[model samples]
Target chain A: MENTIITIASGKGGTGKTTVASCLAMSARQTVQFLDCDVEEPNAHIFLKPRLTREEAVSLDIPHVDHNKCSFCGRCAEICMFNALAVLADEVLTFPELCHSCGGCWTLCPEKAITTNRREIGLIKSGSAENIHFTQGELQVGTATSPPIIKAMKKTIQKNSLVIIDAPPGTSCPVVETMEGSDFVLLVTEPTAMGLNDLAIALQVVRVLDIPCGVIINRGTDVYSKVETFCRENNLPVLMKIAVDRAIAEAYAMGIPAVEAKPELREDFRKVLNHIKGVTAGERTCCH
Target chain B: MKELVVISGKGGTGKTSIVASFASLLTNKVMVDCDVDAANLHLLLSPKIEERHQFYSLPKAMINREKCNGCGLCEDTCRFEAIKESTVNPLGCEGCAVCSRICPENAIEMVDTVAGEWFKSNTTYGPLVHARLGAAQENSGKLVTMVRSQAAKTAKKLGYDYIITDGPPGIGCPVIASIGGASLSLIITEPSLSGIHDLERTIDLLEFFGVPAMVCVNRWDICPENTEHIKEICRKRKIPFAGKIAYDNMVMLAASRGKSVVEMNSRIIDEIIKVWEKVFEVLCPNMKL
Candidate 1:
């Protein structure tokens, strides 16, 4: 049971990435797993309305310093790669937010004052609605790192389930972690010059991962040719285009994916699914 | 100095476009493009980069080929799976140093990798601080913070009143980095489904941070009906509907010529001038623009 993993990502936001991902989950034949890695501001749940069945803390292994155990020594501070731990003659300080939790500091502590502790960086919640199994992550406000929690969500995927991973915006580590191991990546972008340049960067990220990617031009009617020309030279497929329509906006305000709010989007969603199957299913058969 | 940050919860909703237009309307103002990830404000502002500095991200563990030993321990201890075979990838490595420590053969070394470039530039209007993130680099939030901090120092040193920041799109770290200690934020959005949804979330984020904000609806005519819907949403939230920029081809034409639409002096330019005035009035509630 080789499941098809399709990641809906656009280097730029407000391009209907979530709208497309939630719709694809609804259009799937069997169990579709939806993972929202946009922990910063997740809106897929607002559209899908999934009743979260499980809520668990996503923690990191940070070093907790014990004040009573030892004399303040600078050895642990010198060895920390992240500079999370610092020691003075009188007191030791640990900035938990900066800690990457490599456990190096705790092991290297000369006085053995450093002990492992858990810091809740984010939360991962799982639930189901319709034919979709929904799981999403929420990065705690002010927390710097999010890729680790994204990795945790990626591990929750089951076999034979059509997975739609909604990645966060920007061409960074969080986006990379979500797009990893995906069969097909949908790079959503608008038609503006800014959109084209950002999409180019996003495309390169997927290319480095050695994954076949397709571009879906959001707001296509405004500037389709610029997007088409960029994709043409790069050999990236333009699976579908969603034009700028006001009806789609109204549905979004009331909290629903456009495809569910409008039947017209259903046709576009189907075309994208067909293109995904054609690309990913072919790769799966060849591997088998 | 009133700080007007152009921010949107989601990207590609004309934050830079509106900022460029606002910059064009004003003179003798220092503009900071705080959207460090894919900063294109310089593209429209046509700023000549005067000076550049290298931004270094987290260092990556590298296998010293000369230190020769094909040990499997480095690969097994790597938490990021960055160590595959004997080669270590800079992009995937998390800078944990687990590979360097676990290498029994002492063949691994961690090296600082240049992540991106930040620039101090002079635009036709005034000084501009911008950045370009390196290909496949993380730490965009840090780069954005650097730009704003530099811009603030420059504005104060140069004796400029207003330091306008074109913030990054989305409600995440980069945007948070932009919104810090700002006098006011002007969120540019459209009358659409994702626009309203993201706009409300953006409003919440800004309010949560206690940044007083006003809304400027871009391309409202494209969805005239939703324009009213957007207006109602703003009214319910008590967010001042600053004004609307009707959809116009001149925006793209001006951008193609490396100019802000506000410099074009079109009917749209006049409307944007009105929006800026409203922003000034609300942000300065006591003063008349």
Candidate 2:
């Protein structure tokens, strides 16, 4: 059987996506593969505390204008929508930070003067902890883009093992890129107005991507009814609800995974995993 | 005009809640919501759209399948792997025009997609400018720039002295776009480990841009020790540490009712008022709080 790729995402940040991803991966039945796609501010590495055995710099190709072979035709600058390249009479100036690394200039240069050079934007670290294989990406502090690093991290996905991805927050490009190829998406959200509001947007995103998804309510309370109402009306399964536990909060503050500190909660995560497997299996059967 | 942007490195850390509260306390300001990805400020402000504009930032590649040659050359040449058997994955395509330029049959063309829309709306607080990016659309940074530029223009036209912006979370392109050239930024953070880690990254990003910032810890009671640690870091960096707001369930009720914490009678609101006073002192050194 192929390993299922489950991505834990939330439209709102700090809603326990990392907490859920780490705990679920730790509590899984088999050897779990964990990929932290929240490159912008990845926190799974903090909780997992994997002894990183390997590291690689994530680089992108930026156009380097060769003055010797250059006609300075200005075609590269004309095609660049990001204004990353500017054509001068003698030289073509490049802004690597603004470059999307789409390889447009290198391929479209009629003079063939456009060569490419690699610029390191981020780093990927991989290792293992207990029965889990951990891989995470960290975007350089000053870098403005995160999707490319996320893509690089996703490339390390192992299809033969059950993979749990902690996606970046929000419903934008980075989140979209993280959730792209996953078998199922688990949305972790709180029961606040902002949580419910952002969850709706996140739900819409998953629907557009055509991925089956379930919900996990973190810090569950009776204060807000909208999240529950929205889930029921949408027919989305409420997989698990972890109540507001002060001990859990303290453990999280100390960079501890709740399932590790309180072993009993592993049962809760196991149940959630079982539910996800059941739902994913049902979808497969229906499709076949 | 001075601009104060509220940003959190981690999401759902009460950035919107704090900004909504600030909007209530502050007057003669233009409110701008730059979190175009999952915009929630509109839900709180209840703005009435006075003018709306479509935001078309990124160009998407389209394949003219009729130009007829299944060469698969474009797929091989594409770095993003956006093209698959004549179909283009709009999300993956960065619209670099490499496929259109290299296509032997001239079957591909780049067209501007309606990435999102921005609006100038009337709210009780002031004129509000906000935007919503289409789901899975790229160019969030571009849309954020558009929203800020429009907000600046509207602020000038209306003779407003300040621009209060609700910035997006994460230290990425959109977050950069929100804080660029802003007079001041108020970072709303929590006291968790992830919160502290992300806060450091966000502060580093802000310092890299040479933007002066103030810090406020929301739900500080959740982890008082971490909250104190955050204050120590701020003090070491010479960044002003605004007062902390204790956790309160009233914030949840206020959000559900589309109201700011300041509107509700809560001790958290009082702490936010003090934070606003501190921010106002930094934003307008000559003005009285």
Candidate 3:
């Protein structure tokens, strides 16, 4: 079987993106690579508990100056689009938080005094839990950008396994960066108006990116059928529905995956994985 | 004007639900949705845009093919790898201006792209200033700052007493830009483990900014024990505990109907009211009940 990348994302946070990702990866029969790209607030690690085998510090190159070799020409500061550097009257100051690490400042410095240094913005941890290869990134607090760290994490993807990505919530740069290269996207959502609204926005993103996508309605109940109706109307398949179960909620609060909390649900999650495979395979045939 | 922001460390924890209820309950206020990426406040508020403006602050690299010397210097220097020969992928460009500076032929330029649009709208509540960031675009922090400043300006212009903002989730740049310097922030969280984990980080973030923060555990009934844990943590940290709200299907029904809990008849509405009262008391001490 060819390798497939499935990303679980939600327009709204806390709508079970990480939960679904963890359970799905755990229940899949094939070797799985689970990448938690929500660097800002990664939660899958709490559930996966993969043994850490490697930890890599991700850093961005920021400009440093040699005061003695420098004429305090403000040209470097003027060319910096992110406002990361400013040449003050008496000193040159750099705000590492604002730096995008574009390398424009030191490269353009006429005095040849500016050099670049790698400043840690985040770190990626990789290890394995049985059949599942686990990896996640943690962005340092106060770091503005997450795509670079997300990109770094994606570099460790092994092509031989079924890769499941737990994307950051919201349909923005970080989510887009995570979903870009995926073979399929599973948008997790609740049935609330906010969920439906955000789901539509997320659907637009995937559609624009031309990736085949489906919906997984978490916390399912008959009381809120708006999400289901919207998915049906849009012709997007609803692959799975995890009913709102109190036991599952308790297990989640205790940081346990539903498959473990309710052992019967392992069968349910396996069925969901099979359904995803069938759908993704069908789409590939259609494209060819 | 006193600005109060509603945020959650994790998403879907009822941040918007609380903000929507606050809008229905408060008078003389301006609403701002700082969650520009997946903006849903407009769906509930039904804001009719009175004015709209294009937001063009995020810069993208533009290579002038005519002036290109076919030299790969720009590509070699671009740390973001946005430049490939003469083509620049706008999504990959971080707007570093390194390519423009290193281009020997001066073919590269940093140009502002229309990243998003902001609107001044009239809702039943009051003036609402919100924006929609372009899908797959960077710089949500900039759009958030724009909406917040507009909210402040609208509040000052209309002589409103408050600016209530719905902040995005996580302690990222957008969240930082939203809660900084606010009169107070209401951190809405769930009773899940991730909620507590993220809540701690968000509290630390607010502390770093020295912004006074209050906590409200939404859907507290989902896990009563965890809810208790959350309250205990709040007490230990000396953070004021606003209240806990029980999970009610009616909140979902109200959201489906484009209404706040307070706008409907539900028991959760009473709990939200108490939460609001505590929030206002802490945030607006000078105002009378």
Candidate 4:
């Protein structure tokens, strides 16, 4: 079997993206590599319960000024697009939190007074839980950036194993970083006004990334047919519909995957996996 | 004027719903939606746009291929991997302008790209401020700051007593931008493990920024034990536990009809009213409800 990556995402938070991603990993027959790319508030670790085997700190290069060699030229501050640096009459001030570490200031400094230093922003933890190999990024509290941490975490992707990514909510830079190189994207959303609104925005993002995608209507009910109509009109595939079941909610509150609470749901998850496999297989032959 | 921001570290915990309810109940206030990437408050409030402004956050590097020799210096200088074969991928670029600065042939120029749009609208409740970020755009924190400052100016000019903001989810840049210098923040959470985990982190963030905070569990009945745990944590932290709302289907029903839960004739409305009173008392100590 070819290596495949499936990312579960939603524009709105708390739409069960983590639930679906973890359950799919638990039900997969292969050894799945589960990457929780929601660095800001990762919740998959609570359900996966992976015994972490390794920990690594993720850092970014921030500019540090060597004032002794510096003339108050203010060139470094002028080249910084993020406004991370400011030139004063006597000193240069740097705000590391605002810096994107683009290396523009250090590279452009004529006086050679600027150098880069590492600032730790987050951590990457990797472990295993049964057939699932889990890895998640933990962003430091009060840190303004998350895409760099997410990019660091994605470097651990295994080549031979099936990969499942639980993406952060919102269609922004961090969410785009998570879904960039995936083979299939499963968007989880509920059937509500806000849900439909956010789902449309998230679908637009997937379209911009040009990734093949499908929708999973969580907490599904017939009362809200707008999501169904939207998907139909957009020619998007509705892969699965998970009803609003109290038992599943209870299980979720207890840190149990929906498949574990109701064993029959494992087969449903397996079928979703199979369907993705079928779709990707055809795409590989026709496009790749 | 006081600003009360409604946020959830984890998404889908009824932050926007609760804010909409506050809008329906409170007078003399401006409502701001800081979730620029996925603004949902407008769905419930039905804002009629009175003013629209283009939001330009950071400039993107545009190559003037006509002036270029095909040197790869720009590609090598870019840390974002946005340039390939002398073509720039706007989605990959962070708009830092490093590539344009390092181009030996002077082929690259930084151009201001409109990242999103902010709107000033009139809703049934009052004035509302919201924004929509372009697909795959960065600098949401900047856009959030723009909407909030606009709301503050509106509130001050109109003599509004409060600014009720619906904040974005997660404890990231956008969330940080929403709660800074606010009078108080109400964190709407659920009684799930994920919710508790995120709540603790969010409380820590608020504390780090010295922002007074309160917690309210939206579906507290889903897990009574966890709700109690959350209450105990709040007590230990000396943060106010506003109140708990029961699991009610009317919340969803009202949302389906683009109405706030407070507009519906459900017992949940009373509970939400109690939560509002608690938050209001904190925001305005000398006022009578």
Q: Best DockQ goes to which candidate?
A: 4
Sort all candidates by TM-score, best to worst: 4, 2, 3, 1
**lDDT (Cα atoms) of all candidates against the true structure:** 0.80, 0.88, 0.87, 0.92
Using TM-score as the yardstick, the better of models 1 and 3 is 3
True-vs-predicted CA distance for residue B101, candidate 4, Å:
1.0
lDDT by residue (tens digit), candidate 1, A102-220: 77777667778888888998899999897889999987766668888898999899987788999988887788888889998998887776777788888878877878888888756
- Per-residue accuracy of model 3 over A133-179 as CA lDDT, tens digit each: 99999888767788889999998887667999999998778888899
**In model 4, where do residues sit more than 4 Å from their true spots?**
A283-288
Provide the clash count, candidate 4.
Answer: 1
lDDT of 3 at A224: 76
Task: List model 4 lDDT by residue over B24-140, tens digit each.
Answer: 888999999999999999999999999999999688888998987888898898888888999998888998888877888888998899989999999999999999999889999
Candidate 2, residues B189-274: lDDT per residue as tens digits? Answer: 98988999999999999999999999999989989999999999999999999889998878877877777788789887778889
lDDT of 2 by residue, A1-288 (tens): 777899999888878999999999989889999999888888898899999999999999999999999888888899887789998999889999999888888888888999999999999999999899999999998788888888888888776888999999888889999999888899998887778888988998898888888899988877777898999989787888998777897798889999977899999999888877876767432111
lDDT, residue A55, model 2:
94
Give the range of the ten consecutive residues with the poorest summed lDDT in model 1 chain B: B250-259
Interface RMSD of every predicted model, in angstroms: 3.4, 1.5, 1.5, 0.7
Which regions of candidate 1 fall more than 4 Å away from where they truly are?
A222-224, A283-288, B65-81, B84-87, B101-105, B189-259, B263-271, B282-289
What fraction of the true interface does each of the listed models get right, in terms of native contacts kept?
A: 0.33, 0.74, 0.73, 0.82
Q: DockQ of every model listed? A: 0.31, 0.72, 0.69, 0.86
- Per-prediction TM-score, please? 0.88, 0.97, 0.95, 0.98
- Compared with the true structure, model 3 gives a TM-score of 0.95
Clashing residue pairs in candidate 1 (N, C-alpha, C atoms within 3 angstroms)? A249-B193, B9-B170
| Full-model lDDT, candidate 2 | 0.88
